[model samples]
Target: MDRFPEAFKRFEKVVAVEEIETFMQLRLAFGSWAGRKWVPTERQIEALNVEAARLRLEGAWRRETIVVRGKPHVRYRDVRTGRFIEKPF
Candidate 1:
């Protein structure tokens, strides 16, 4: 049985789920006719992941860090309410 969606092969959902920055780049690339037909190389995916990590570390898209039961955790922010939330299931 497969856990990932069928679109995962094209990285359509994979990139977005793994990293927002990568999704943004993927979106941009798909905006063009030529780019839409292109498949990203593994190196490109790796680079996107690295860029996403760099942005997160720099707080560009600040995910809130919270301490729960003496353990530190990070979560995405709800832009509408400015609240941190657990991973969306």
Candidate 2:
């Protein structure tokens, strides 16, 4: 499975998902050409799991450092909330 919607392939260029800056850009780029809904194949579902793991590393986690008792501790920030996660799930 591709990281982006299959509809994105219609464009002249396929960009990395990380380069997509906003949801509106995604909606405008792919939402208007509506079509039938479909289910993922078993193979595609496996690929989706890999893609999801990659996406988690890309966006689900952000790194931060904190001090505890004169020691530095690594932490993560929740991108949506702008708060320290301390340790991510």
Candidate 3:
């Protein structure tokens, strides 16, 4: 039995990349005004929560980077030849 799903599973709560980017900007903007005693508007708070949950789910599927010999390696693409190159230590 395949441990992975036979078909790609779509998230019911998928967030668009643009939305994520906008959420990040909003967070930064709010952070600058964090010292204010006034609470964020309900819509703003809801957006933040939604973004946070989406981020958590997205982060779970994120590819991890491993460092080797002080160099970060992911794919084996040659910078000069523009070809796939095997990793060489």
Among these predictions, the greatest lDDT belongs to 2
What tens-digit string does per-residue lDDT give for candidate 1 at 1-89?
13222333455533443444443554354334225544465444334434444444222223567799999987766433456655422
Q: Give the alpha-carbon lDDT of every model.
A: 0.43, 0.46, 0.39
Q: Which order, best to worst by TM-score?
A: 2, 1, 3
Report the candidate with higher lDDT, 2 versus 3.
2
Question: Residues 1-89, candidate 2, lDDT per residue (tens digit)?
Answer: 45443544443245455654443343333333323332445443333334434444333435567899999988767555567765533
Q: Of the candidates numbered 1 and 3, which has the greater TM-score value?
A: 1
Backbone clashes in candidate 1 total 0
Ranked by TM-score, the better of candidates 2 and 3 is: 2
- For each candidate in turn, the TM-score is 0.28, 0.32, 0.24
Q: Which window of 10 residues has the lowest lDDT sum in candidate 2?
A: 29-38
Using alpha carbons, what is the TM-score of model 1? Answer: 0.28
* Per-prediction tally of clashes: 0, 0, 0
